[model samples]
Target: MFKIKSEVGFDMAHYLCGYEGKCANIHGHRYRLVATLKSETLQESGQCRGMVDDFTNFKKALKEIAEDFDHKLLIEDNEEGRELAAKLEVLPNNFDIVFVPYRTTAEEMSRDVFNRLKSKGFKIYEVELFETPTNSCIYTEE
Candidate 1:
């Protein structure tokens, strides 16, 4: 099998609702994500022969996903999330919010992004999400 991967990084802030510790408070991280794709076949050409696939297309998709979350608040769905966002909205100006269908954890985000790429008919092998420089997680369907 042939594999190709791409990565992107961004900044985000989030708080875990209903948590028992300091995690309940708002915090931020410089996040990075890596997406891998696999294929067993490649186009036969003068410059592209025997390659997995065109890495340019994979990079484009990764860029699109990264742009969606850069410099945004990664909010999870909960009473706290709603209330805090409401308060922020009432400030002098407004900030953009990125809401996940589930908690704003690396695991959930990884799975969500993986599904999104897969739904687009991409040969997604895995998604790796780095919530911190030392902490990261991966999600794969197969």
Candidate 2:
């Protein structure tokens, strides 16, 4: 199989409610997302002939995904988080909030990004999300 990978970066803040660690408090990260796509065959016609996919298009999609989270507060769509979000909305400083179906963790983010790209018709092989320069989480289908 042939595979291609693209990397995108964004900045965001999050907190794991009810956790007993420093991460339970709000914090930010310079997040990095790596997406991999795989296929057994290459295109045989058109501008993409003999290529897995256009690198430009792949990077553009990744960038769009990254932009969605850039400069935002990512949080779970729970009662507490929602309430906090509602309160924050009225603050003088404009804030961006991204409510996710799951907890705001690197592992869950990887899985969420993988599913999103897959739904866009990409043959996603894996998604890796870096919470720190040395820490990362990867998600892939078995």
Candidate 3:
């Protein structure tokens, strides 16, 4: 198998609603995401000959995902999330809120990114999202 990896970084804040840990408090992370694409054989014809896929294309797809989350607050779609949205909205040009269907955890984010890139026609093999420089969650599908 031929595999290539690309990475991008984004800054975002999130809180775990209803959790008792310190993570329940709103905090930010400079998250780094790495995406791996795999192919059984490299393209033998075309501009991308002998390549699994263009690394630039992979970075572009990742940049799209990064832009959506950069400098934004990711909130879980629930009661508290709604409340936070309301409060932030009142601040006018102060906050950018991004609502997600589930808790804003690295595990969920890895899966979400994996699906998103897959839909974009990438032969995605895995997605790894880092909550910190050393802590990360990796998602893959067989």
User: Candidate 2's residue-wise lDDT over 55-109, tens digit each?
Assistant: 9889998999999999999988999888888888899878778899898989999
Give the lDDT of residue 133 in candidate 1: 85
Q: Candidate 1: what lDDT?
A: 0.84
Best by lDDT: 3
The alpha-carbon lDDT assigned to residue 71 of candidate 2 equals: 90
Candidate 2's C-alpha lDDT?
Answer: 0.91
Model 3, span 18-76: residue lDDT tens: 88887877899999999999999999999899999998888999999999999999999
Counted clashes in each candidate structure? 0, 0, 0
Q: After superposition, how far is residue 13 of candidate 2 from its true place, in Å?
A: 0.6
lDDT of 1 by residue, 1-142 (tens): 8788989998888767677787877788898999998888876886657776567877888888888888888787778788888988898766788777688889988998899889877889999999988999999978
How well does each candidate superpose onto the true structure, as a TM-score? 0.89, 0.95, 0.95
RMSD (Å) per prediction: 2.0, 1.0, 1.1
Model 2 backbone overlap count: 0
